[model samples]
Each structure stands twice: as structure tokens, then as C-alpha cells.
Target: MGKPTGFIEYDRIPSPVRDPLTRTRDWNEYSLPMPVVDLQIQAARCMDCGVPFCHTGEEIKNGVSGCPLHNLIPEWNDAVYRGEWREALDLLLKTNNFPEFTGRVCPAPCEGSCTVAISEPAVGIKSIEKAIIDRGFEEGWIQAQAPQKRTGKRIAIIGSGPAGLACADQLNKAAHNVTVFEKSDRIGGLLMYGIPTMKLEKDSINRRVNLMAEEGVEFVTNIEAGKDIPMAQLKAEYDSVVLATGAGNARDVKLPGRDAKGIHFAVDYLTQSIKDNLDNGGVQTLSAEGKNVIVIGGGDTGADCVATALRQGAKSIYQFGLRDKLPDLRAIQNPWPQYPKVFQMDYAHSEAEAVYGADPRQYLVNSTEFIKNEKGELTGLRTIDVDHVDAERNLVEVPNSEKIWDAEIVLIAIGFAGATPSIFKDFKVAKTNRHTIEAAKGFYRTDVEGIFACGDARYGQSLVVTAINEGREAAREVDFYLMGETFLP
Candidate 1:
């Protein structure tokens, strides 16, 4: 325990943030640095409960009750409280491959299911985590742990997203010659382009990738497994193969006037904005300046679009969600220790409110079609309010609720359906119904003899933590399969 009465003595304190008005003007991260002393105080609040639901990492109502990584939360909390930061980092890295990435971007399901959150605010799990890892970097505690002996087994991992990176990190620990192939030009796949730089800085990815390189893990970018290099060649060269290609088949909004010039998928828009920010000398090439932006589908991606649009000087922005506004508090079906499925404002929401003077989300509404001008450029949208028939998710359009909304640009942020199927060809790997690789009923083994799959390629679009878990487990399974028994964890 951090302290015997620490929970009672201290209250929760979140990480400080920059004022939204000032922060939205730049592409840099907005989270202000937290002092180590203040973060240590917050870490002291961990109660170290007997059961410690925060570490269970179980599935509850499709959400994780605790950390999917099953991070040694309480143990690290104690270490942090005692100011043993190096020890804390060791504990954190024992399970997670990248605490810094998760600390910055992850939603922190651990906090939602926190025992303290049943009453008062939850422990500052995410903030404390961030503090620990950041301090580790600053103090030069983290270093490459190159394996003493090579197993002489070569492993090829396709896709360099969280799943692929995590899998490569673990496989490297087993002394396997791990080579990561990324289709994109950069090493971090989704971590690179999919997420906006304002939330997670590019240097974070660069630092980790460099460290992995020093650890003897070979990274090959701009060389897609199936297309650039034939899949059969990879299978022939590597003793074991892991398919970690993330679920990138973005779900699109099927509406009339879909051929309009200004309509774009969330990934395309986000990627373009990131690329512009990186390549065009900090200027947005796809600027939404002086435009009325209508964003369809409300989620993290939609919120990101809103923030990106605001930064690009959009005149007005509206994000639409077909679902009704959620209750402020947890519902009957939701209980403590299960991630609270209640209304919340993410970083982009606060930024939007700062710029627009209100939350821009329009709930229980549907964009019927994209309204286009004579030039086929999207000038607006025709929308209608919707009502779900019941919890079963039947929908009906409401009469007299139709309205025309002005928009120069429309972005669809609905989320992804599954992985692209073309890449799995030539390898002759079986597939599941969800379009992911077909693994053994309870294992990561695919139909192919020595091929395995994990992360979004096996389980569809999931959180970074879940992807890390999949990669770690898949590596363990791969080790077991190769050695006929294994010691890698």
C-alpha cells in the first residue's frame, strides 16, 4: 500500500492542461507538464484494495474492468508514493510495452473501474503512469535489453501499429530475430498517422522506435508484406509469422450525394491533416478555414476532426451522433468495477466548446444526405432527427424533424469494420467471420502451420491496451509453438 490511510488523507488531482483557447492555435501537445511531487501525491491515493479490481483486467459488458495489460498498478503506485521511480518504471515495463504511449492516449479504463471512483474521484492512474514513464526517460532509466543469445528463429510481423510493435517487442525478448514490416512510410502505423499529433507527440513514437532498433529489432517501413514483398516469400524466409495489421477498413456513412467533392472519411481527413502538419511546414494543406464543417458520426475520431477543423480556423463545426444523449450517471445495467458508460467530454470536446461557446454534438440526429452545389462541391447537408425503437437498436426517422444544415466539408468518423482482406491472400491463412485471421478457437494460431495473428487483425478494431495484450499473448503462444515449450512472457 502507498500509505495505510493515504486514500483518506488525500483527494484525487488530475493532470493539469493548457487553456484550450491558447492551445488550439498550435499543433503541439496541449497537456502541461506535471511536477513529480504533485504526481507522487496522487499516486499515494491508491488504496491497494484486497481484491484490487483495477488489476483484474477482465471483460465486463464489452469494456475492460481494469487495465487490459494487467499492469501491476498497486505495486507501482506504492513505489511511486515512496518516490522509488526507477522501481516503478521497472514494474510498469514488466507488463506494458509502452507506458508513455498509453499514458498519453489511452482512455484509462483502470480509472473507470477504480474502487475509489465508486464514491470520490478515482486515483490519478493515467497521470501517475505518465509521470513515471516520463521521469524514466528524463532520468535515463530506460535502456535497450538486447537478448544475450539469438534463438536463430526469424519472425516477420506485418503492420507497425500498437499490436505489431508490441508483438515485435515481446518476440525480440525471446531472442528471435524480429523484423517489423510497415506499409506506411513511418514506423508507427496507427500511432503515427491515425492519431493526431496534438494528443501524442511524434517524438514519442520516434524515441520508442529508436530504442527498439537499438535492441536488435529490425524495422522495415514502406515495404508492405503482401504487396511490396510477396507473402509467400515472407512465409518461406521467416520461421514464424505474426499478422498484426490493424483493422483499418473504416466504416463509411452511406448517404445520398456521396460523390460530392468535400466528403471524406475520418481516416483520410485525419491522415491528411497530420501529413500536412508534418510535411507542409506547419501549414494545413487541407485547411477548413472559413468553412462550415458538419462532422457525421460521433466518437474519438469525430472529436479529433472537430479539434483539427478548429485549429485550421473553421467558421463553424457540428458533430452528429445518431444515438441519444447518455445519462450523466451510470445506468442500472452498469455497475462500479465495470467501465462506467456515461457521458464524458474528451480533449477535443473541451477545445470545441472553447472555440464554439458550446458543445457541438447534435445527438439523436442523422444526416440524410450530402447537399451539393452546382459544382458538385458539398455546400451543406440535409439532416433528420432519429429515434431508436428500443435498446435492440431499431431506428426510425422522425417526421417534421428534418432540417438543412450548412457545411462546406463533411467528415465521416463512424469507426472501422475490420481488416482489409487482400493482404491475407497467397499465405492461404483461414479467416474468421469478422474478416480477421482465423485463429484456433482459444489460441492465436492461424490455419497455417507456423503463422499466428493478433490485435485488430484477429479481434477487429480495439483499444491500444487490448492490442498490446493480444500481441504479448500471441508472442507467448508463438514461443511455445517454436520451442515445443517456452520461457518467454
Candidate 2:
């Protein structure tokens, strides 16, 4: 789909990040932009494979290959290769509503499944995507696209995160009057608060939100749908309701003295830190200043805590994980086309190591207890070295391998437990065994008529791209339910 010999001539080029030492001092986005010429060269590397697996994003059971949204990778790659920036933007926006957010934050499963990755590195598909969209914005090619006519229908969207926003964007384009309800004081649910600004600057979110408003989508913030406004009122007012409240229930690290004063959930800690930085113009409250910090759970959330702590002037940081470390290269069972299961570095991990002079992660360590001081403040964490054993390979502590980690603040970044029931208290929507909203097996409809759920609330915690896909799908369903048929793509 690209130049005939492009893959053979051009090597894969990675997007570069700002200097770690300097970037750690602020919360601004740390990644630098690539010039369009270099980006086109990267796009030229897409080889003409018999079939494209980059965007056949399905249940992903076989492995994490294919784009969940089934993004038109080859089409857009060819456009970028020809310097057809506008065409590339149109193709990208066809599947993804917010490439700007995904460009900065998404893990890029698209690259992992790229046909070229079978031999050489995949085409710089993601970078080309970011470049195309960014170029579109720079040249004022993107604008508020109001529908030509009104469908005379209304849709109420709960939550302003990726899913909520995507659904709102689609439903609005279908000429439905859409109102997005957010419990927080601002738009962009987790996108606004849970994620650190450096990953996705709030300015970008504000810009899209403002454009949505111009296009006739209403955003109401600081109002809980169930508590502030009853579900009955919304049901009576809107033709359909979309519940996109993300799965926000944080998984707890069960250990003695779990209620220690310094213990914090990863999302809450990150939210407060980000809100404080945005509102107060600096990290005021929840500052990690001059304190020994121990972060439990070595996932993306944990990595974020480490970076936040670094920016807050932390004394020292340590991330503990009960699971064994991954291999540097892909294992035999983990083959190509599947998302690479090899050990890799993220922005926060790189920044932590560069600034702290050491990798902050320690694997195979299980936290057994939290040691607190006389006043009930966290002082340290007691843990034990463990190994995987038994038929289930459950973690087993090694005898005489106990150790106490010195710390003042402990951030639990163990992940989420799906959506909580209290938010759905009024809707009366049933939940599945996995604790997510119960909808059609292959659709976004709920048991209740005219009610729908998508994104993390329905699928459990997932990537931003997955959420966008679900939202779009749900909007299509809602539109069909309203009009008895829909032109929503």
C-alpha cells in the first residue's frame, strides 16, 4: 500500500521524548512532535501484506492483534506516504473519534499486529496517525461539523470520558440533541482527572469539548445522574440514555493496617495531584515531597504514581509487584501478530530510571502488612519474597525472606474492579458475572428499553481505543432504536 520498496529502504523510526531530567520538573507533555517529511517516510514502510490484521480488532481472545476499532491502517498509511494529510485525517476520523488522545496515550496494539512486524518493525503507523491529525488541526482542516438537519431525538450521555465523549460526538452527528452529564466539576471524566496532564494535556480535551458545544452537544458538569438528577427524569426526557461512567472501583491491596493515613488509591491520588496542579498552578495538596514512597502494583497506574511522585520531589520511590518479571524478548508461546508480551519501557518508567538513577521496580515481592507510626500515619511496609507454585501457580512466600520497606506514602495501583452498583441504583440495569453492565451478547443494549451501556462500564477496564469503539457502536444502536434504522457508521 506504500512505496514498492519502501519497507526495504526505510528503517523504522521511533517518536522521541523530551529529556527526562528536564521534563520531570513540569507536567507538560513530554513527547516531541515529528516533522511531516520524516513522518511520511515512516508511513512509507507499510508493506502490502495479503491481508491487514492491524485493525481487525475483535474480542482479542487469540491474542492482542488487530485494531479494536478496526482502524483503516493501510489506507491512512498510504495517504500519509503520499503527503495526503487531509485524506489521512478523514480516514483516521472514520474509525477513531479522538486520535489526539490515543496518539499520546494509547499503547498502540495496531503496531503489534502490523503485517510488516512479522519480519522488520511495523510501519510507524501510530506516529503517522498523530502527524496527520495534528497537521489537520494546524492547518485548520478540522472544524465544527454541525449536522444538516435535526433528527428531533434526544440522547442523554452519562460521563465525559473517552466513551461518553465518543458516543456524544457520534449521536450529535446523527442530528440527535445530546447532553453529556459529568459528576465532576469539569468535562472529561477520567480523561480530565484520572490521567495526568502530561500524558494528555487538558487543553486538547477543552478544544474538542468546545467544538462539540459549538456543534450543539450540551455538557453539564458537577451533577451526578443518579443522585443529583434521578434516572426517571432522564428516561422521561431523553429518547435514549447512554451510561458510560467508567469502571472506577479501584482494586485494594489487602494487608494489615490497610487504612493507614498515607495509603491512597492510584486514581484518587492521581486525580487530586492533577487537579491541584491544574487549579492551584502547582502540586500543593497530596505533595510527595521529601517522603519515601512505595507503590504497589507495577502496571500503568503504578508507573503514573512513580512519575507523579518524581515531579512532586519525592525522596525515593519503589514499585513492588507480586508477579514475576517478563522476559526481555517475546517468549515462544507469545508469537508475532499478538501484542508483544516482552518487557518494554513506558514514559514514566524511563523518566523514573533517568531521574532516580535506578529502576524503581522490584518483582516477586508480596506486601503482607503496612507498618504505621503512633499517630496512625504510614511509616513503612512489611513484605516477603515469594515464588509461584502449586497447580494454580499461586504466590507462595519463601521461608525467612521477610523484609520491611521503609516508606511514608503507599500508593496502591493494583487496577480496578469494574463499575460500582451505586451509580446504577436508579436505572435498575442488571450486571454480569464479571460486574460490568449486562447488555446484548454482541450489542450495546441493556434489558431496559431505550437504555444502553458501553466502554469500561460494560466491558470492564480497557484501553481508550476500545472505549471509543464501544461508544460508537452504542451510538449506532441508540440511533437505530430511535429512527428504526440509522445511517450511523
Candidate 3:
């Protein structure tokens, strides 16, 4: 530890973000960098606990407790505190393939499980992480480091999201020739499209993708496997195929007027919004401007929709979550070291409240039907309040509690079901009941030989850090399969 009693001397100070009211006017990133001194002070708060659960990366109950990437948190914190910026960056890159991505968007479960959090506020681990990576870039410490030797094996990776990118980076580092395929016009699947620019700017993604390209990894955009290119063709050309396509098949709501205009899935809405912003100079083809937008779901995606709508000048905004409101403090069931299910205002919520003078979230409400006019354009929706029943936490709609609200646009942000089933039609690989690829526990190999699945395609929807872990591990497995020896770590 850089400073043994530093935790006692320093208080937690998070990195500042752009003002909610002012930041909504533009599509730029909202997070502002913390000063080096303040960041170092925050890092000093990392206690020298013998058992640091911050990087345990385990799932307790239904939620992940720590960083899924198993980041060396304390080590990097010590390095940062000692003003060894290069050393901190080195330690960070050893575990996380894309700290810039996870540091921005990942809901830091690492902080939740921090031993310091048991007493005081948790260390600003995510902020420190972003600082280290950002500094690495500014100082030119991060650059293309192509493998000195080649293994002479050709690898084709489907999907260019975090998982696919991480897998490609590792396999390329192991000296294998790797090519990544993406269906979109750009490389990053979720990072490029699904997330709004105010959270993670697209330039960050492009910067990393450029570095990877310079390192000898080939990127093929506007190419989708099982469509323009068949699985059979890839299998014949490449020594092995790794499926890193993310889970983006949105869960549709079956209700009256679901086919109505102005109703869209969250992923589709977000993807289109970002694309329009990039291509059409902020004139969104599918604009939410002046419309009373209703977002049906509660999570980061739904919040993103709310934030995007705000930037597009939405007249009114409302987000409905089926679950009950979380408590202000951790519940008894949610013990220490578990990711706390507590109430906290996310950035989007803050922005919405700044504009609307209220949080805009309605909890414990389930949508019943989408109200629409004869022209089949969404007008609003009906919902009923639900109450929790028994220890099992089953939901029961409260009688005579139906309500309706005025809305012109509806975005379904419920969640993704899993990978697109159509992609697997040609592969003939087994799929789970949940629609994910049927890979063995702790292994990425599919029933079909020479093919493997990882990331959201294998584990369903997960965090960016988890997807990176899946990609790195799958690369190790593929390396072992190709050369009968594994060196990727």
C-alpha cells in the first residue's frame, strides 16, 4: 500500500460530470476528468485489507458482487497514489482489455464489494480506472504493439463488440491472424450504437479500434455472418471461428397496438438515434422531439432512452419499471460484499429531473396495453400497480389501480432475450432454452467442432467487463485448441 493510513486521512471524492441541465444540449460526453491530485487522494482511500473482495468477481444471489474482469484494484490504486502513472496503466491493461469502455459505462460492482464500503463510502475505483487509461492515452503510453512473431493460424471472429474485440486482441497478441466481422457500419456493436454519446463518446471506441487495427487485426464492417457470408464459408477459410455476437434480440411486448407506429424496441431506438447523430448532423431520422415519450422498462437501457429523448427535445418523459422501488440502504437480504440493490439517481435520471422537476420514474407499474389512434400511432399506454406477495416476491396487480398517461412515442427497454436465433440457423449449434448458445459450463466450445461462442451470445446479456472476460477466456480455449498449448492470460 502506498500509504498505510491513507484511508483514514482521505474521504471519497468522485470524478465530476458535466452539469445535467447544460450537458443535455449536446451529444458530447458528460463525464469530466478529475484532477490528478484529487484522483490520487481518492486512490489513497483504498484500504490495505488482507482480503480485498473488490475484485472477487463473483455472483452472489442474482447480482455480480465485484469486477468481473478481476481487475487488480488495490495494486493500481497504490500505483496511482505513488504517482506511477505508467505502472498503473500496465497493471490495468493486464486484466481489462478495454478499461475505457468499462470505466465509463460499467455499473461498478467492484465498489459495492469494496471492504472500505462496509464503513465509509467506497473508493472511487471506476473514476481512478478511467483516469489511468485516459492518462495512458494522453501520454502516448498506449500504442500499437503488434506481436513480434506470427503463429500462422487464421481466426475469424463474428461480432465486433467488447467480447469480439477482446478475443481478437488476445488471439492477435498470441500471434494469430485475426479478422473481426461486424454487421453495422462501424466496429463497436453496443458501444457504438446502443449507448448514447453523452455517456461514452464514439471517438473513444474509434481510438481503441484504430489501435487494434494498427496492431495487425483486420476489421470488416458492414459484414454479417450467416447472412452476407455463410458460416460454411468462414469455417472453410479460417482455422477456427469464434462467435462473439452480442445478445441484442430485444424482448418484445405483446399487447394491443404493439404494431402501432412510434413504438420501438430500445436497442433499435438507441441505434438509430446514434446513427442519425453521426451521419445526419444531429437531425434524427426518428426524432423524439416535442413528443411525450414513454419508456417501458427500467435499467441502464431505459435510462439511456430517457437521456437520448431529452437530447432530442422530448416534450415529456416517463420510465416505468415493473419492480418495486429499491430501498435507500441495503436490505438485510442484500448483505455486505453483495452488489447493493439501493436507490441512487443515475445520470439520466438527474438530467430528466433537472428538466422536468421530477424523477420521471414510476416503479411497480406494469403496462397492460398500448393505446393508439386509428392511424396506428401510439397515443399512450395503460398500466396497473403491482404489489409484492409472499417471500418468493411474486407480483400481483392491485385491483382497480389501472391508469393511463398521454404519450406519443413508446420505447420498450425491457431487455434483450438473447442472441439472434436466425444466426444459429445455418450453424446448427445447440441453443439453450433462454436462446443463448449452448456452450459447456466454464468452456466456450460448442457441440460442433472448430466453433466456439463467448460474450452475450454465450452468457446472454451481461456487463462489458464480463464480456471482455468471456472473450479473453474463449481466446485461451481457442489458442489451446489450435496449437494444443495456451499462453494467453
Candidate 4:
């Protein structure tokens, strides 16, 4: 929109990243910032289509296509193209309460539905977003904007993940006193611990948490609501309560030797790594050095395991997925404007390939059991080939396809099932058959009056953007419940 022919004249460019070999030595962010001028050029690539599917944030069958926060993508893209960074930041913050987190870690479905992507590569919308927020910080434009008047209403938000933070931000803006309770030692919940530092640095989370604190949002850490603190106290003290606790009960693989000592859950391993990196002078309690590491899932968490193992100087690493290899390009079943689940190298896989001789991912493989040593420590794994049929059919394990691979340590990266036990019992919230909080789709309210839920706890989650959207929607509902009206737009 800035220059009528900018989409034709300019090509999409991603932010520069350090060479994989050079970056794995430490747990620091590797993506180098794109220059302001180059970012502007990339922003110029937005066609800002009449339909603007990029901001519609709707899900089509199995895939989501656009920004779930309904971010003013076109407006901000134009503002960035014209060097109005302050305005761009304002527009971004209008919907997404935390751009710093999403800009770094979100998969950027907005690009998948971009009007420009129909013909050519999509504009570097994610990189432009990151640059806008980074520049906002650098130029002192980002600050604490506490409300001038208080409605004298109080709200308690359980869990300090993205959803809770987003809800607190909006509620505070509505002049309500908000307090976020986190079970972990620090705020930011999964953002602080569950995710690896290489992708989203801890400092970025700290920056936002500090700002939120200045804006009068109180954060209490190490006090779990169901255990250390009582849920009755929370319910009695606050006018309303919002349950934003994420779904953290990890799904476990039921194998013959699952009780082996060296086998760990992906969340546990990742949390320990983050704790070691942030607190203990970078001394890891469980190092994968000189060992054969096997990651038993191929999602983002499994990829993170690969990268962390590489950083720990593991001798070898292998990642296994039950599904067949995805096509490098979109398949016939997947059409335009849908997020393609095609094969691509994430940062960790890129780093693993750089250090090892080849990519560490193996498709259509399933771990049968953990092979152990005399001391009951994990020494290796037994795996077999698997075939997926229709939804009604079971996974058929191929005969004569079993194999054993040396594995000193095994990390299970299978996804989570639902919220942890304490959240459900403490709050007494109703749950669906899937064990997630029972909330009608898009309406994040519980059967109990004055109680609400959102994020992974509400919808079981698909992405961080979805969680942010849930938080925004939940805040609107909470506002209406309290004041009989709302102004959350």
C-alpha cells in the first residue's frame, strides 16, 4: 500500500540468522535483526487485499490461515513501510497485548494467508513485527500505561502464561486491579521455562513482565493455588476469577520399559534446561554430553530436544515421528490460503544438521520400548515401523521391522493431554470429554458464575496466537460479567 508497485518491485526477505555451527555454543538468540530500511522494503510488499484474509483469523478444517488476534496487519504493515514505527507499535498493541513474545515464537499464520503469497512468497510480516517491537524498546516508545481511574473491582488470574498475561493486560486497561498467580518460581509461565532460550530469550520475557509490573499488574510466584494457597481465598478475595492455567499434563508413551531412569518427559527436560541456564550459572543437572540421545516425537518440543542435546555436546541424536514425511510443498489435499504442514527445517534441525552429518529426523517410526542397562538406566531403545490408515483403523505395526538403537537418554516429546490436576480440582471447573475446561467454542466462560477459563485450559490450544485471542475474548466476557457492559475493543 505504501508504494503501489512495492509488491512487484520487492522480494520477501527474512531476518538474518547466525550460522548454525557458530550459534549452538550458547543458549542465546540467534536471529540477527533486519535493518530498518530493509524491514520497510519488506513491509512494502503487503498488497493489503480487499478481503484481507490475513487478519480474519478463521480456522479451515485442520489448518488455521490468519492472525488469531485479528491484528491490524495491513495497517501496521503500511505504517512500518512509511517509517512510522511508533504508530505501527500502537496498532500492533491494540489487539495483541504482547508482540515481543509472538513476534519471536509464533509460527506466523498471517503470512500463510497473505494476499501476496498466492503468487509469490509472502511478505516478511513476522520479521517486520519483531522489528517494530524491538525498535519500540530501543526508541523508548514502549512504556507502562496504567489506567488513570480504578473501577475498584479486583480479578485473580491463575497461571502466568500468555493467556493469563493477555487477560491481565486488558483487565488492567479496563481499570480493574489484576493479580497473576504462577506456580513456577518466575512469571511468564511456559514462556519463561517451557520454551528454549535459543528461540525466545528470557530477557525478552523479563522486559515485558517488568513493564506489566510497572503498570500495576501484580505477579505472585511459587505459590500454587491448589496446594500452597487455597482456591477459596482466591475466590473470596477477588470480585471475579479467570483460570488461564495452560494444559500441562503431558501425554506419555506406554512402552515396555517406560520406567527406565534416564527416560524423561519433554516438559520436565525443557524446564530443567531453562532453570539450569537461567539460575545455576549454566550448570546443567542432566547433561546429554557424549551420549546417544533419542527424541521420541517430532513436534516443536522434540526439535527443541535435538537442539538442547546438541548444545550439551551429545555424540549423536535421532528424532522419531510416527507420521510419514510431509511433502516439501503443499499437497493436493491442501489448497491455497491454508497453512501448509509441508516439510521444513526448524532452527534446531538446522543446527543438528550442521553439527551432525545429516538431518536427525526419521519418519514413520515408533518407539516400542526403552532398552536398559544393568543399573536400570536407559541404554538404548527398540523401535518399529508404523503405518497410519483411516481414522477408524488402528496403527498397523509392520512385522520384521523392529530395530534397536543406542540411546543413553530418551526424551518423550509427545504433546500434552489437558490441564494439570490441581487446576481442575482447585477451581471446580467443568471439563469436556477431552479433559479441557468446558467452554463453548469462542465463549470462554465456565458454568460457575463469576468464573472463566481461556487459553490451553479452555480450547486445548493450537498456537500462541490462539491463546492470545482466547485471552482477549475471555477478558471481554469477564468485563461484561462485572460491569454489565464492556469496552475491550
Worst 10 residues of 2 by lDDT: 56-65
Badly placed stretches (over 4 Å) of model 3 are none
Residue pairs in candidate 2 whose N, alpha carbon or C atoms collide under 3 angstroms:
54-67, 55-67, 55-70
Per-residue lDDT tens digits of candidate 2, residues 74-129? 99889888888889989999999999888888888988888888888888777777
Kindly report which residue stretches of model 4 are placed more than 4 angstroms away from their true locations once superposed: 388-394
Against the hidden reference, what TM-scores do the models get? Answer: 0.97, 0.98, 0.99, 0.97
Each model's lDDT comes to 0.88, 0.88, 0.92, 0.88
In angstroms, give how far residue 172 of model 2 lies from its true place.
Answer: 0.6
- Top lDDT model: 3
Model 3 agreement with the true structure over 248-294: per-residue lDDT tens digits: 78899999778888998898999999998889888888889999999
Residue pairs with backbone atoms closer than 3 Å in model 4 (clashes): none
> lDDT per residue, candidate 1, 251-351, as tens digits?
88888899999999888898988888778887787779999998898788899899899999999999999988888999888989899888998888899
| Cα deviation of 411, candidate 4, in Å | 0.5
